[model samples]
Target: MGQIIIFLVLLGLGYFFGRMAESRHYKRIHQREQAYRKLLVMPEKIPPLEFSQHESTLVSGNVVISVDYFKTVAAGLRSIFGGRVAAYESLLDRARREAILRMQEEAKAKGADAIYNLKFETARIGQNAGQSLGSVEVLAYGTALIPTPDMRAERIARNNLVQGK
Candidate 1:
């Protein structure tokens, strides 16, 4: 009985703290997302015609998020019943969004006009990953398109100058 009581208390504490931390993290993510909204990110293999002549470089970001104690306990209970483990949904969402944000930051820093061929890779991390709850690693990758002066526009300007018109 005493052990059960202690476990319950720990679970309550975990739930309370986990919620607070997740809320704060979500707020931060939202702010960063708004700030980086202008940085175009796309999953299409081919860039738009405007970016056809742009330089390309690989950019990636990865984040490992650990499940809180409460989430682990809740997920274990949910697994026994055989249904969706909603407890871990937020965890994955946060990890994926963070990874994308980081990738966007990298592209912006490199003066990229846009990111193309966006891709995601996720994996379970930490000890005993298969047997128990563990951290999840989310990786976001894409090709950044850095703009160069448009060759067509340059040619037109050169011709105009040559013709003095």
Candidate 2:
């Protein structure tokens, strides 16, 4: 029967897709973790020159990344039958955390002692031509400031010396 043949085709397609998605998500997660690790590797090395006291303040930046087209197609096929797709959720969650962590590290590298001004923006990137199973991403950033009186004094002295006011 034609119906039977169509059903077989769909089923075969689904199986193949699911397998491919399994591997793709595995690799994506691996890459995401590696990215997080790279962001976190900022060693606490002082600059070659004598460190100047800076009353650092928090600053931040953010971005969102959508799921790939292949991923969307695979998820659509899987959704025709069952419960939630845990892999998709896990991937997005990990990405969100990585984005935030990257922003935090960026602030730290810029000599911020503590970060304060935080913001997050999220939206789906470009859409795919076929499947509509995309995701929204959220990014955040903040400034870091030193919390020491010595730094505050130095900053004040510098400001006064600059303006002669």
Candidate 3:
């Protein structure tokens, strides 16, 4: 019957649109994950006289601080439906990597070969608290070691001789 064909077509269209919307939301999350991988860092504090004079001969590393947010919003919307959404895994993974990379760059800029004492934390903003929009923020820092000012000068001279140009 023509009615049956029309009904089937309508059903097919609905399924297609639903799939598209779901995929679009997921794609946006993926893009966020990618952008999250690009670590953004600020800078180190200018130490006073003592911090400047201390020679960093021991082993240590920079610190990375991060928060994971995924459950609060999902909990809010899940009550309206019969199921829960598993979307936070990728988000958390991406956030962790972002924090590490940021700290790594900071340590490298400070001439530190390694890092230690890394840590993490988490908190939830309730849906009613106006902070459950599903965003994670990470802050990382570390004590970096630079060569002695004299050694730096000598190293530069050695490099200048190698090229001889």
- Where does the lowest 10-residue lDDT sum fall in candidate 2? 41-50
Let me know the TM-score candidate 2 reaches against the reference structure. 0.47
Candidate 3 lDDT by residue in tens digits, 44-135: 34434434543443222222222223244344567568464554444455555555565655555665534443554434333345744345
* Count of residue pairs whose backbone atoms collide, per candidate: 0, 21, 3
Off by over 4 Å in 3: 1-86, 108-114, 125-133
Can you tell me which runs of candidate 2 are displaced by over 4 Å? Answer: 1-58, 64-66, 116-119, 129-131, 134-136, 147-149, 152-165
Q: Report the C-alpha lDDT of model 1 over 1-165, residue by residue, as the tens digit.
A: 999999999999999999999999999999999999989999999999988888999999999999888999999899899899888899999999999999999999888879999999999888465755688999999999986657547767999999999
Model 3 clash count equals 3
By TM-score, rank the candidates, best first: 1, 2, 3
Clashing pairs in 1: none
Instruction: Please report, in order, the local distance difference test score of every candidate based on alpha carbons.
Output: 0.92, 0.57, 0.49
Cα deviation of 156, candidate 3, in Å: 1.2
Candidate that would win on lDDT: 1
2 or 3, greater by lDDT: 2
Considering every candidate listed, which one attains the maximal TM-score?
1
